[model samples]
Every structure is written in C-alpha cells, then in structure tokens.
Target: MTSHGTTTEECSPTPPTAEPATPSPGLYNADLAPTARKGRTWRSYSIFTLWANDVHSLGNYAFAIGLFALGLGGWQILLALGLGGVFLFLLLNLSGFMGEKTGVPFPVMSRIAFGIRGAQIPALVRGAVAVAWFGIQTYLASVVLRVLIVAVAPGTASWDTNRFLGLSTLGWISFLALWAVQMVIVSYGMELIRKYEAFAGPIILITMASLAIWMFGKAGGSIAWSTPATKTGFDMWRQIVGGASLWVAIYGTFVLNFCDFTRNAVSRRAIVRGNFFGIPLNMLLFGAIVVVLAGAQFKIDGKVIESPADIVKTVPDTFLLVLACLALLVLTVAVNLMANFVAPIYALSNLFPRVLDFRRAGLVSGVVGLVILPWNMYNSPAVISYFLGGLGALLGPLFGIVMADYWLVRRSRVDVPSLYSDRPGGPYHYARGVNVRAVVALVPTAAAALLMAFVPAFHAVSDFSWFIGAGLGVVVYLLVADRKGPFAEASGEAIAVPSKR
Candidate 1:
C-alpha cells in the first residue's frame, strides 16, 4: 500500500543530494545548514576541547561536589562517575553520528524526523532550551566574578543587601562584566570558540590541579570521602543512581545538540576517540580534583565547599587567590562562549535566515538571557534541579525520536534535497508538512517525563526521567509511523552516507 503519495518500494532508494551550499535569500541561511565544505583538519583534541568547554565550569564543579554528598565514599563515587561518563559518551556519539554522516546541523538534520516546515517545532523548543541554559550558565559563570569583586573592594559586600532584581549591585556589575567578555568572545565567532576551548581547557585543568594540590597540602595529610548520610544497601544504590542522573543532567544539554560540532569533525573515529578522552576519562580526572577540593574544605573550614570562588577565598596567600580568580574568570568565559553561545546562533538563524546571522542571534540570545532573571532562579538547589531535569525531560523525547527515525525507520537514508523542500509530495512534507506520528509520540512521553520532574510524589523516580521519556518516544514513534513515510526502510539496509558535499 502507498503512504503519503509514495509506495513502499519507491521510498527505500538512496536519498538525493541537498541544495547548493549557498542559501537562498528568503529563508535559507548559510550558517543554518552544512555547506559544500569537505573534510576537516580537526583531531581528537578538538573533541577534548569541546568537552572542556562544556564541563570546566562552576556548574559542573558544583555538580561534582554534590555527588560526594550522596553517601558514597571517594572510591565508590569515582566508580559511579566512570560508569555515568561511559554512558554519556555513548549517548553523545549517537547524535554526533548523524551530523557526521549527513553534513547537516541538528535542525536541518531534524527535518527528516519532523518534516521541513514541521522541523520548526523541535528547533524552537531546542532553541528555547539553549536560551534557558545560556542564561543559567552565564549566571553561574558570574559567581566567580561576584566573589572576586567583593574580595578586592571589601565594601562591595554591602551591595548584597542593596540589590537589583535580587542580584547585588556588585553582582549585576560582575555578571554584566563577564557577560560582556563572553559576547566579545562570541563576536570573534566559532574559530575563536574552538581556539579558546583548546587553549583554555588545559589552563582550567591546570588551575583545578593546582587548587587540588594546594588543598591536599593543607588538608593535613591523608584524604578520604565522608558524608553525613548513612547509606548502605538500596540507599547507596539510590545515591549512585542520583549521582548518575546528575552526571547525565550535567551533559544532557549537549546530547541532542552535539551535531553542532560533529558535523564539522575530521572523522567519526576522531569523534569517538575525543569523547573517550574528553568525557569519561576527563570526568575521572576532573572529579578527582573536585573530590580532593571538597575533602580539603571539610578539613580546613569544617564544611564542604562547592563554589570554586568560595574555596579560593579561603586561601591566605594573596597571589594564589588572585590567580585562582583570574583562572576562573577565563574558564567561565570560555565555557559561556562554547556551549551556550554557538547553539542559539544556529537555532535563531534557522528561524530568520534572511534577517539574522550568528552574531546578531548571539546578541539577541544574551538579551533573552538577561530577561529571564536567571539570577533569581539559579541560586536555589530546587530550582537548579527543576531547571536541568525539566529541560532534560523535554530534550529526551526530541533526541529519541530523531535517533529512532534516522537509525531505525529511515535506515540512515536521509533524502538531503527533501530536507529543504516543503512541497506536498516531498519526502519529509508529511501530513500537512509535519510528522504527526513523531509529535504524538513526543507529547505523551515528554509529559510523563515532566511529571516525574516537577511533581512532589514522583520525585523518587526522577533520576530516570530522561531515559523513561526517550525510551517511550522511540518505541511509540516506530510503532505509529507509516512504513512508506519518511520512516520507510528496507530490511538489512543502511543509509548510504554521501561524502562531504
């Protein structure tokens, strides 16, 4: 039987070539999709740099410290982190493979799953996710600056009581200051983001290393992880699960949007190798430093310090304090540019291709970031939990559907030319230009995930929220989809990946 004006036999052939690299003036933007660019010179280090850019932040550091509070000793925490990191690597590469194979950005690649015009649904949602995170990360990055300003001037502490929009006068200044520095980095664009990540990744690692060493030196000898909780059986396992969930949430934003980088990768092999070193291995090393820092905090101050700036403040040496603060500033700025800055540029560019480019979109994104009043939202642990967990719930379905359609139903045979076409009979222009099956599956599953996140009763199962949503989305989409629609595939076939166009 035919579906959507196409026969099953006819739908299983190789996809046609996409439009020319140069986008048309109306709705096509060069930055919105992959161009005719060929292979890249990027190596595994670039992947490492990307992870560094994504993870070397106050947010990640705080998350690491939180893991220790989960009733796990240092050794057990390390094991949980390693397991989570390995899974995270696998999840990332799934999305990365699509871009590497297709040479398209995430939104453009999404056309196959959601339809050319319908792709806007996922694009807008993902874009909004970027905005929220961009704001949150900006606020987190500025925390170091806030610590620095108060320390240097001393009287700046008064601004905390005399506040603007719940942020201190000094807080506002520091936030804006780092925000400006981030935009300056954005103005220089992706090359600078790449170069900065490559350069700053090592510096941040070294800084963390130095801090860890200093902490160990002053920790008064042996190091061991001890928390207040008395977790032994299921309780310990629950903590491990919770730690893994946090680990997933830490990099969850990137799993679906990773194509923003992998599409430009030198090879699939490089992507894998880089992720191995950059994520799981890097997490091991970075988490060790964080563990040590937390241990030292307990030794010296009788409390676990999660905030890097606060930890630095405890240092008596003037030079080390200033150096740590500066290193943090650089780290924060680098992360803000790499993770938060690049995705929104492409996302907004997709909406108004004729009107806005990456730079303009970036400027607009910063404005949106400020408008969200992220300052008020970011400080609370409950808010952070909801923010990251809730967003991950939404992202879970999107990622699941995309991966399901690409790898299973489509058999990787994405019709590139059809990704841009909105004609009634075009490959992706299903049911009035949207894939109703995908949306139907996405809504219910995503709602289920959201309920797990926000509802007080369901919070116990919140650790598996992303997994639940994604798994349900995948199963439902495959079951509901028309075999002759975009999901059509021949048995034992693989999507014939066209080389760099």
Candidate 2:
C-alpha cells in the first residue's frame, strides 16, 4: 500500500503487539506500534460511550445553550447541529482511517503530512490548545464541587469568600484536589481511561436524562425554548450559521485526533459504529436534553441559566441535589482528562520522545496549564472568543492537509519506519525535515481564517473558517504537490473518497 512521494512504502503484515495485563513503560519503542498495544480491541459500544462522555459535559451543555441564544428557533438550531455533526463525522472517519491503516496516534500519523520533523508544528498547536482547555475544564469541574460542598455543609461557605490569585480559597483547594485525582487515573494509562469512561459515561447520561425529566415536571410539563435576554439583534439565518459554527469549532479539534482511541478498535466496523452512535446520534440526543433543561430553567427563573451550578441551586431535595452535583463534577473531570489532557500529553511527548516520556510530558503540560490561570482566561468573553476562535481556524486546515496528503496525495500507504527515522530519502523526509508545501498552504490559509475571526467586518465569515481553511489548504496542497498523476497510481483502490453530502 505504498503511495506517491519518496516516502511511500508498504506496511509489513506484522500483527500489533498484545496489550499487557500490567502497565508497561509508556514511551515510544521503535519496534512497537506507535501508539497502540498489539491485541486489545476497543468494542464499538465502548467507543460510543466515549462520545457519550464527551458530549455529556458542562462545556458541551453551555455550547448547546449558547446556540439557542443565536436567534434561531428550536428546529433551526437542530438543523445546524445536525449539519455540523455530519461534517465532523466525515472528517473523523477520514482521520480514523489513517489510524486503522497505520495503527498510529494522531500526532504520530501527522508526520505523514507535516514531515517527520514538521509534524511537531500541528502537534504543538493542538497540544497547547488542549492544555488551556484542560485547565479550564478542571476549574469548571471544581465549581460543581464548590456547589456540592455548600449544599451539604453550609458552614464551609466562608471558604468561598477568601480570594487568592482571582480564585477563592475553596476554589483553589477543589481545583488541586480534582487535578490530583485525574492525574492518578491518567498515570495508570489508557486502559484505566477506557475503564473510567465506560463507567462514567453511562452515569452522566442517566443523570442528564433525570435532570431533563425533572425540569419538564417542574416547568408544568412543558418546556419553552427561547433566547436569553442578554442577546440582542437576533437574526434566524445568523443564528443557524452561528450554531453550526460553534459545533464545528468544538468537534473539529478532536475529529482529526479521535484515532488516538479508535485505532485500538478490533476493526474499522467498530470505529464506524462507534462514530455513528457517538457524533450525530449522541450529540443530538444530548443537545436536546440540554436545551430542554435550560429552557425549563429560563421559564422558571425568568432568566436563561448557562451554568449547571445554577440548575443544581434550584433543586429542592438536598440529598439528591448533592448527589447530582457530585456526579456532574466527576463527569466534568472525566471528560477533561480524556479529551483535553491526553491530547496535549501525546502531542508534546512526540517532540522530545527520548527525554520526555508520556507521564513527564503530561506533568509539564499540567504545570503550564496552571501557570496560564484559566479562570482569568474565561473572564472576558471578547478575549476568550479571539483566543479560541484563532485556534479554531487552525483545526480545519490541519485536518484538510493531513487527510489530503494521506488519502489523495500520498495514498493509503505510510512508511512506519521513516516516521521515527532521521535518515535522508526516507518517505516523510523533506528539506530540513519539514514539508514546505504543507507550510505554504497551512500558513496563509490559517492566517486568512484568523483575520476573519478578529476583524469585525469579516465576522460573518468566521463561522465557516474551518471549512474555509480546509478547502483552501486542500486546493493549495494539491497544486503545490503537482504530482497528480502519481497520486492516483499510489492511492490505488484503497482511497475512500468522502462523499460531500
């Protein structure tokens, strides 16, 4: 399955290594599959549970509610969500294919497009973003802890008043505690993560379902979905686009990286089934639950509730409230660790593979996340928008270029050895170990998308920046590569051309 370009080579039909019952040293071993254990197979349902955990989070809840505030009706919002999910599903399938074919992690597989050395560019960018998100999610999880503490022990409310470094004393304590707990689990390795997700995912889903049912009963058996008062100048079309854009931004980051988990699947059918149940199906169900719950809160309180804490505050039963809050807190922490923490750890570790092992890379990323003070990062909406928005722009182009090179340009074949080798004439080798064609396309495309994000006049275009960057990168990379004839020959019959439905 070798492809065009000097780097293409067929993979030997060697079986992946068997998963050890005990933990193994978590470092890149030349003889081992880049990021997969040999024989462990993740079932399709387990993958669905992964998506269930991903979607059932405080951040995801907030994002769904934010879409309603974009001036679209419930039906319109659903349309946007559906459309975005479809786009994300396609992209994820493409990325997941590479993982299935090569049995590599996202950062390692990226070497195919960015060159063995150049892969670090996308890796670092994605890693840095994940770190910021990790801190923010940790902080968010702590908020639920604070609420539960106050609910159960009223006297401890004083801890919320004493402030340091923009966080209350209790806030810092909860943050550190949650951070440590997650570290313990992550340190154990991916098997532990898989186990935790399988358990936590279902619990969160049940809780959310219960919350939705309770809200419905509390609102006199009806839910009224409406925009928040804080939002102004509503337009239906704009809302739809805005809703779709929000989905794209959140899903885009992981769509290209999900292979980090999916590659462990027993088969490609398992990955597809997991994705089917996860993205479109799970997201829609979760979004509907969130919207209904949020809308119910709005009718009862006469104001839209953005935070899960706010909903928890309104619950009457002290014991049930405490339990729910605790569950939500645990759920948030789980999602943060799996989604935000793991991505960056692997991304950064690939940079200095020998010196920085997985655990050390994770610790370094955690420390950097703490230094950033994510609470301050979230304080200003405008600042958060620009920061996240700029990063969002990069995701589309990176996904586009990587997939294009793998499926269209280089074909399905990837040289596993060259991915780690520094030898000249290796498949992934480029001048100075960087692919200028990828850079030439990635830079300007990303810049254009960023400009649309920061500049007010170009704000409308910002929502589709992912699509814009992806399209631009694909076009530019194709022209620059200029090996069209060779691409078809190398691709052979293995290339799965994504239907643009």
Candidate 3:
C-alpha cells in the first residue's frame, strides 16, 4: 500500500517481446504463486483460519496454562496475552506489506537487507528453528495418537514396557504415524494446505468449545477463578512477563514470513482486517477459553492439565471419544504444516534456488526435524525458553532493519529483478556482500537479549528483550549507516520503478 520512490508513467509502448508470454517463475517461485493483480478474497478467509488453527490448538492451550501457572490471575494472564497479540498484529502487518509490495517470500525479501548471497543467514536461522519445532509438534501429535490407539485397542498400552531409543515401540509407531500424516499433507503444497486449514480450524474450535462446556458441567458449577497453586507473590509478575515473552517469541518467528500468504491478498486492507480478527481477537478469546477450562480442570481433576489430549482422556462418553480423536488428529496436522513445514521449505529452497525446489526443501526440512528428536528438546522448560529467546532476539533486529530500509531508506519502491541479480552493480550488492552497519547493530542487540535469557539477574530485561533488540537495531543502523550523499541515492534507486512486472 505504501509506494516508495517514483511512480510508473506509461510510455509509447514498445512492441511486446516475441518470446513466450509465460515468464519464468524465477527465484521467487512458489507452489502458490501470487498473481500480479490480486483476485482471491477466499485467501483472506483462509489466512484468518490459518491464525485460528494456530491459536486454537494444544500448544496455545498449554501456553495459556503455563502463564496461569506463573502465579498470574486470569485477568493478568489475559492482559499479557492481549499485549503480546498487539505486538504480533503490528509485526505481521509490516511483514505482510513486504509480501504485497514484492510478491516474494521471506527469504527472497531478505536479499534487500542481507544481500543476495548473504540472505542465507536469515534463511538458515529461520529454517533451523522451524525444524526444531516440526519435530516437537510431531512428537506431541504422536502422543495424541498413542492415546487414541490405547483407547481403541487397550492391549497396545503393553508396548510401553518394551522401550527403544528412549521411547516405547508404541510411541515410535505413533510418532511415525503422525509424521507420515503431516508429510502427506505438506507434500500436496499450498492449495491442499489452504483447504486443510479451512476445514480443520472450525472442527478444532468446535471440539474445544464442547470440551470447555463439558468441563464446566463436570465441575458442578463450582469452577472458581483461582490462580495456579504453584505461583506466589511477586513471582506472579515474573511469570506473567515470561509467558508474554514466550508468546511473542512464538509469533515473531513467523512474522517475517507472513507476507508469503499476504501477497495473495485481494488488498492490503484485507490483510489488515484478517490480522486484526485472527491475532488479537482470536488469541484473547482462545486464552479466555483456556483459562476457564484450566480452572474447571483444577476443580474437577484436582490438578491442571495443559494438554488437550490429557484433558480429553478424562472424558468417559464413547461418542466424545470419536470426536476428540478426529479433532486432535486434524488440528495437529494443520498446525504442524502451517507453523513449521511451509516456512522451512521456502527458507531451504532460497538457499539454493536452482537445485533445491520447494518439495525438496520440505523433504530436507523433514529429515533434519527427524534428526533433532525434539521430544527431548521440550523436556527442559528452561532450555526451550532460552532457545526461543535467542531466536526471538534475532527477529527484533531483523524486523527493525528491514522495516527501516523499506519505509525510510527506500521509500516504498523495490527492484524485483535486481533482488535476484548477483552482479556487482545489483541494487542489493554491498561491499563483501553484507551490510556492516546492520550487522553491527544486530549482533550486539542479539547478544544482549541472549544474555538476559540465560542470566537470572537479568530476568526482568528478558521479558522485554525483543523490544530492546529491535529498538537498538533501529537506532544503531540509523546512526552508523551513511544515510546521506551517495548511499541515499542508491536507496532511492532500489525502490524506483524502472520497469514493472
């Protein structure tokens, strides 16, 4: 929506080229290529559902309970979630703008800031994080499968006694089954993903609502709004901040790539409206449901159960069993593909455009995720938090630098071809193929955030590390980077419409 440099002026049209009208998809190729002019309004709906699938799931529920466990009251936890969602909404809008402007994926867009060759740094950072999450989500889905299997075939629980590679035979089978389901869905690419999300999101929402209702009934109208027993005193604020930080970290990873979907939007307005409904409103509502359900569980079961599978296991009705299994299976697959699979596929493909196509990149990501065995990764909360903190720290600086360059430095224009061109005179080319000022700002800010993550003395700072890193990056780049003279001219050229796609 924001135009950067000079506007295009029609000239006495030259004869069209004799070559075939079908241009090569080039470096920005995707399974769902964005149209030069948008048409799909359904895409806005699909994206809205995408966020719903993201927020109305096991991970989201667990995160809410985790916040409550921090000693924060329901109101405080809701406030934290609301604040985190506000940040997420704004970040997504910026990232979405990039996609709409460039019609490129996250990795391709990084070329502006990181240089064409150097773009791999952000790609690898995003890809590695995706792979880690992929494995963890896969393991979680497998746990759901194991539950269903034992529910149907009661003797299958005996397999738990015979362990291999730190898991039972049943666990391995369940894990593989879940892995296979996700791989199959993702292999179909974005169209299938869109359809899957549209359906799965509603089903998951319905099941969660039903579960919440049933949980309330089981609690005998005595579900008091009480904080988790584990938290105490000022530690409640500490916990609330920690929960907010984790929420930001989760959303920040994908914020960079949000434009991948937004590029297909009918208009920037659609993207904004979708984000408003999907992020803050949806997350807050889901958080409220989670809090109510968690409180109900505490009253009914004598403890808080974060996992939906764990909560559903307490239900006795045979009819409910069928619905719960179906809901969990569909929801897990949806989240795994949307949140973890797609981004990494694009990230890896960007690393080597010619050889590694989207499908190959997806396979590579899946294999790497298998290597991590992320069930082990999520075993330690502190380690998981630290890892998330490190990734989140990078996001702020990256966002700051990219947004500043596009909005302030370049105005709004982007040279699409030059983004892929590797020659010396290319718009993105810089000395030694990296922006030193951006790096200088990014590195120290990330270091500061990481220090906060690991050091108990810096605990207060840790909660706001993303903001700190991002703000510092913006300030440092603005001050140190040569914004006057020749550099300013180059910045203008980068965005000017020399030609149109």
> 290 in model 2: Cα distance from truth in Å?
2.5
Looking at model 3, the pairs that clash are 4-412, 4-413, 413-495
Ranking by TM-score: 1, 2, 3
Model 1 misplaced stretches (Cα beyond 4 Å): 1-27, 37-41, 150-161, 228-230, 379-389, 485-501
- Can you write out model 3's per-residue Cα lDDT over 1-501, one digit (the tens) per residue? 333221121211222222212313344343323334433333457778988888887887887887665566667778778888988888888888677655566777777777766777777777777788889988988887787888888898999778776678998998888887777777766667788888988888888888888888878965746644656567766776667767877676778677656555656666777788889998888877877787887777667676777778877975678679879888888888888888888887876666676667778888888877677787868657777546756877776776776666666556565565555655566755566666776677677767766788987677676777667767777777656523221111222221112
- Report the C-alpha lDDT of model 1 over 336-445, residue by residue, as the tens digit: 67667677777788777778877888889888988888877667777767765576578878878888988788777765545655566666778887888888888888
* Backbone clashes in model 2: 3
In TM-score terms, candidate 2 sits at 0.88
For model 1, the run of ten residues with the poorest summed lDDT: 489-498
Q: What is the lDDT of residue 265 in candidate 3?
A: 60
Residue-level lDDT of model 2, residues 166-262, one tens digit each, is: 8998899888998888877777667778888888888888888898898889999877766543333446666676677668777777876876776
Q: What TM-score does structure 3 among the candidates reach?
A: 0.87
Ranking by lDDT: 1, 2, 3
Shift of residue 96 alpha carbon in model 3, Å? 1.1
